[model samples]
Target: MRVLVCDDEPLARDRMRRMLERIPATLCVGEAENGQELLERVPSVYPDIILLDIRMPGMDGLQAASRLSESDSPPAIIFCTAYDEHAIAAFKVNAVDYLLKPVRQEDLEKALSKAGRVNKAQMLAVRRETGVAQPEQANAKEREYISVRSRKGIDLIAVADVRYFLADQKYVTVRHSQGETLLDETLKELETEFGDRFLRVHRNALVALSYIEALEHKGNQFYLRIQGVEERLAVSRRHASSVKKLLQSL
Candidate 1:
């Protein structure tokens, strides 16, 4: 398999090249110092996979990945970053995997294997023979996942598994199928990103539209009954009417 390494540091690029040499049946097609250089080299190298760095001097990996996603056929991306915070953003661009810096050989091998499988899926898709989903479909909110820091490193919780996001003071708790986790982002930012899938039932809460089983009123207060949960979230009067209308439409 042909691979391209893109990083701002020469030492980092050299290190990645050495790692690729150790992996059998893999060839390092080219190396780039930054996103701009990477774009310039891709047409010539035609790499099957890209080892991309998140932070760069010009046109970072995320921006470059976005541009790549718009192409007729794009290479599978594996983000190699020092920070875990960008994991969510990485997957948003359809990254095959997120590997932290000082990457392990076993992890690289696994990610490459996944990328190879995805490449085959894309090929089948081109022939109109398979319904396998491609990475570009991740642009939609329904295909997106939320990344959170955990004791075991980063955990990607599917947006579909999420029930609601309730904010209290500084932290926003994400309630999902696997329980709850605190997300670093704000409620307003989440509302903007996932407005179509999640409804603002109150100033401090955003509930998944698919999970809303019923909206009830008791003692002049509106409450939302969420599926699979015993706790009822209080809906403020300001958003009660809009919530009701949305429920009717659903």
Candidate 2:
């Protein structure tokens, strides 16, 4: 894997270069002191990944990442920062992983391994075969991830991975394959955005239509049974009829 190290500190850049040398099948193509210099070298070096630092003299890492996101085949970005406060902002710019400094060898290897799994060449080949959309059109609609703020950091969950969303007071709990995460977005806003795929089961809950296993009735209350989860979600009387109709359609 071709990696470009970008940091303002000379020692920091040298340390990254040395680490990359130790990793097999990895090359440190170039090093840049700031974001502007990083951008200048990117076209020529054509790196697969960039180990970026957040704070610099000019054109910070976030700004540089945003600019790179516009490219058709942008290199995957792994942010190496000392501050944890910028975690939210870093993932907002679609960073692959945010590693706090001084970064560990294991963490760097894991991040690179994760980034390598996304095969851009294979994606383009499939797109061409299916005639789904032009490369520019496909790239334009790439923001399918939902960013959730948590105590650890911002976690990017793909919309397809979600099973249901349950509203509890100010926050919404997003139930997905990897378990649940708290989201700041309201249930109403989520319904407005993803109404087509998500069904309104109650006033406070929206379930993914794809994961609807069955609807169960116990006493006077109706409950929804999800495919993978054992816990059944309560179905309100108001939306029960609509839910049944949706089930029949499926």
Candidate 3:
């Protein structure tokens, strides 16, 4: 089985690499210093399991694992970190294992033995636990995940995937990169919750400003073209001013 190690510190990575040599039938495929680098390597290396550190410079291990779980086939995640506070929360997410540093040879072997593929549900749980802001924490962060029902049970989509939310009577259709999802959330609630990320293009629609490609006009009616979405959403006259202002800011 192939194993990938990700940690910011060189010594931690080296130690994990040396321990991998002791595990039977295991190959140390690669090592990454940060989450972004780890993501870039996964497509090429296709490691069966990843030894991910919880604390890092930019993206934390939890956030990184959340993104990885969205893939068609995600690698088994074993969070190896110095922090003990995150251990209980880790198991809630069904992580293969959580090894405290310095990770022992026995611990590494045990973690790999029970390692299994993690899904997005567990990743969402992890995201919720990690995203909580303490009273002392400066950044009072909102959840990065939006839970929606799918054929594969509850699919937790990264907010960045959402192109827009259009309210249709009782339901709100979330148009994302992959496809649209009918959710129970109200447009007003969504607008209030994600006001910073999304913009009201119409009374019935809240479009993600990050995905807004350009605003177009068709026979005196305005429409919005999104980056990854095919359908162009109609921009109401009431919101055209705000949309135009947003384009100017962008």
- Model 2 residue runs over 4 Å out of place are 119-250
lDDT agreement with native, every candidate: 0.79, 0.77, 0.73
Q: Deviation in angstroms for 12 in model 1?
A: 0.9
lDDT winner, 1 or 2 = 1
lDDT of 2: 0.77
Model 3 lDDT at residue 187:
86
Model 3: per-residue Cα lDDT over 1-250, one tens digit each: 4588999999988988988877654667789998888988876554668899988988788878888877544778899998999987766655688888888888888778777224223333332343311122223465687998878899887776688999999999988768878999898778767665566778898877545656788998999877667778998887686566444322
CA lDDT for candidate 1: 0.79
The number of clashing residue pairs in model 3 is 0
TM, every model: 0.51, 0.50, 0.46
Report the C-alpha lDDT of model 1 over 196-229, residue by residue, as the tens digit.
5566788899887556666789999999987668
Order the candidate numbers by lDDT, best to worst: 1, 2, 3
Tens-digit lDDT track of model 2 for 110-144: 99877654424433443344332222222323346
Error of 2 at 4 (Å): 0.4
Which residue pairs clash within candidate 3? none
What is the clash count of model 2?
Answer: 0
Candidate 2 vs 3: which has more TM-score: 2
lDDT score, candidate 1, position 233:
95
